[model samples]
Target: MSTSLAWESNHGKDPDVLIIGAGISGICTAINLLRHTPIRNFLLLEKGSQIGGTWNDNQYPGCCCDVWSHLYSLSFEPNPSWSREYPGQEEIHAYLKRVCQKWGLYSFIQFNSVVEDARWDGETLKWCSKVRVTGGKSEEFAKEGYVIKSDYLVSAVGQLNMPYYPDIPGLGEFKGTVMHSARWDWSKRIEGLNVGIIGNGATAAQIVPEVAKTAKTLTVFQRTPNWLVPRDDKKISGMRQALYRYLPPIRRRYRASLMDFRESWYDAAVVEDSDLNNTMRDLCAELMTKQLVDKPELVAKLTPNYPPGCKRIIISDDYYPALNRQNVELNTGTIEKTTETGIVVEGKEIKLDVLILATGFKTVQFMYPIKIYGENGRSLEDIWPSGARAYLGITVESLPNFSMLYGPNTNLGHNSIILMIEAQSRYITEMISQVHHARSNGHTLSITPSNCTVETFNEEIQERLQKSTFASDNCNSWYKNEDGVITNNWCGNVIEYQNRVSAINWKEYEITGSCAETLLKKDKSRLGRVVEESNSALIPIAGVVSMAALGVAAYLVRYGPRRIR
Candidate 1:
């Protein structure tokens, strides 16, 4: 649980890269750097005591992933021993920790260190990050703040890190225990107590069933209803686990099948009135009708008026059944205020012993409360006053040698985000390789996407989002900002994103510095080298030989053997 003393010993020296979070995106990026790129000196600054970004934060009752366990893991390090169709929070966290341990990532991570601000030093062509060490296992560095500089800076503090609380009048006056879904308090017991929960999104759907089993009386205050579908979660048998563990091909095939099934639902998510969308809507309706057959009144209140994919579809098998309990009640009224004892809705105050806020994260604000200055002392906030924008959701226009993972317009509505993160990690490592190549020649270098490239990319994204279900006027979800701009989700399927970011387009960027001329001359040769080196581990020997042959052909077509290294 202590911070890495090795990282502390080299505090003043500059690393090759500095990553801001130790979650899935950050850890995946670090692994890619170690395995693919030649950048050895990199640091990961984590605000929490442990890794597993979302999984570590959310510990409420019934917290689990909606995605299948097999499809949700890293492609290179697939786990064949999952206990269920969908893994719970603890299992996912443990998997990440094991992956970190296997890849030796703990030595590069500094826990309990919060990044205050980071500025791109145009003169030095490096990112100077100011970090504050919060007292925990890192208490020795808590007395004062310190600065860490790196040639490249990556912001992996993802979209869903900050919790959002509704501005309800007099919410602080309540004397009972209050808790957000992300920051769960395990010591506070709600058994035999009348508990009330506000908001009815995916987290609330998971929580309602578990709390109803023990609470004296549970009241759910919902603002809007979400499309409810059957999760169909089941336990994985020991025989199946053993088969997957022993035969790697079977595990690979299983994971591929899950990914293909999930990808098939892409049309249902993006096409508002397509046949697939209608079919999914019918399935969700059938699930609600069968689950709430006895309680006809509850079914009417739970039915969503908007389209199925307007908001995130809730997958649950027990939510409706939990609502059918005699002691549970669903309130879809306007919240006027909150009193000392409970919530007041529609001129009536419902007494409660505990209150839970299931309101989700501030996803639209990609990176807030962290001041970031780019070239010529330009603030990132000033550049992105409207909303965050990045070319391929990785590099911004004004930020030089800076990249982001899981940034705007990269979140998925139907498939696993791990796929997107992997694509991004590969793309980023390739870009960093260019900078490292320049540094090895004793010349400073910085790279950023052209303003026109970012603008054109975002224009296409926004236009495509207009045709998707998420941009519907009838629904308000976390996928957008207050201005109704679709800022969080990608407009296409995962394959499209992966292919788009698979290779770096040098023409789209504005590369500068003392080595810009030399780097530009060797772009094709460097690209070929990166492709052959980075993916050698993933392919079989025959595949690698074939790829090497293809790489030589590409090199010969572009430049002669004299340019080969």
Candidate 2:
């Protein structure tokens, strides 16, 4: 075992909550805990030394969020000073850091500590987690393994962190610098080197455009071409930035406009063979044709055979133009194997100084490589033999007191994920509040979504997904599992999902414990307290104004200009 500070840390000391990753989801969860709940004994475990999960890991050239900056950020903490309409990786990472610092979350985060496994201890009524501390050179068990306990567990480890490299034969024997786009090697100079990149999804699309500018020769192996949409990314004007900083109403109006525009494409995502889908397909084709006007041969190879939303629509203004470069060659031939010098494509050896695997992540493998033992020692892998499912993509049956953010079936095809994360965070905080209230009243509450409830929800969503464009067999995408079930996406619009996860129904859960009645009473008491506290804050203002005038003022504060701020 490697070094771990098991003895030094507060290991075995039970916290209120244990969050797995330090990504945007994890940060949002922690912020919610700090703002909305009274529970302070919580910890965040991050395998890496830094935060910003995907943003920190990906630093490749031309890498930026496809979602616009204003809409991609948290609703409570908007960044009015974005350098571009779409901020790059460094800026996003810095934004996360600033949020964490503002909330004083660094003290609660244990860096370089990876969670090995989490087990539900039935006797203790708590989760016993096994953690492994990395970065220490010494091979000592005391410094390697640690145990911590928490009443609740949160899996905030997002989908894209794990890099997927194809098991091409003789890949290990290739005498070249091999890397994945997710794990870019900045040290290896590609200024004049021949580079061969495999896969042509979103990551490859971004990588190729930038690499073509510097590489002596670039070969992009396309398994399937994705629909290219013009990004039209531009720098935000100074006047707009100043207005957003000074006028809250203007900032909110702009955010709403961007949000509405993104939502308008939801019809194209879900309804296959509809007018919206056809119109989008035609527009993407026209855009592709405009970019490759000079090279007719490259146009066909770059065009997608699948529907626009079947695979993710690539957002780039330069990817099509980069494919027309004289030094760049698009190879659609099947790769036979990797030779000692280069990759064999249709029996021809294409020599390369570097080989890059741009294959996407294991999207279906939710809570992957981590053994999550639910009630009676049932593993998560055994439960999701076909694919992962959850009631509202948050809670699962048999996995009591465990919740996930950005989990299965919650990924959106038409909108920003930050919105989803906020919704999920609020829902998780509500559940945490429930557990806290119950436990304080001497009840050992174990909550799992009723199996029937989860099944019904998954069945309805999967059925709708079958009618969606992602069900098209034209391309093999990472969105589906081995069973061809679309486990990575929400089959409806973002507004629908926002409404679904906003509140939790008590009847939907299977609650246990001898003190269940007492817990219910406490739940009502908590609700009453919230109402009374809200009314108490309005008393002083109520004293100076007439009843009708006070009511009007209160309504204005709730839904007017003050609401925007």
TM-scores for every candidate against the unseen true structure? 0.91, 0.90
Candidate 1, residue 138: Cα displacement in angstroms equals 1.9
Residue 315 displacement (Å), model 2: 0.6
**lDDT tens digits, residues 458-531, model 2?**
99999999998889987668889877889989988676677677557767787776555554554322111111
Candidate 2, overall lDDT? 0.79
| C-alpha RMSD for every candidate | 10.7, 9.4
Global fold similarity of model 2 (TM-score): 0.90
**Candidate 1 local accuracy as lDDT?**
0.84
By TM-score, who's the top model here?
1
lDDT per residue as tens, model 1, 232-296 = 67899999999999998888778765665566677666679876677666666666666675687
Error of 2 at 333 (Å): 0.4
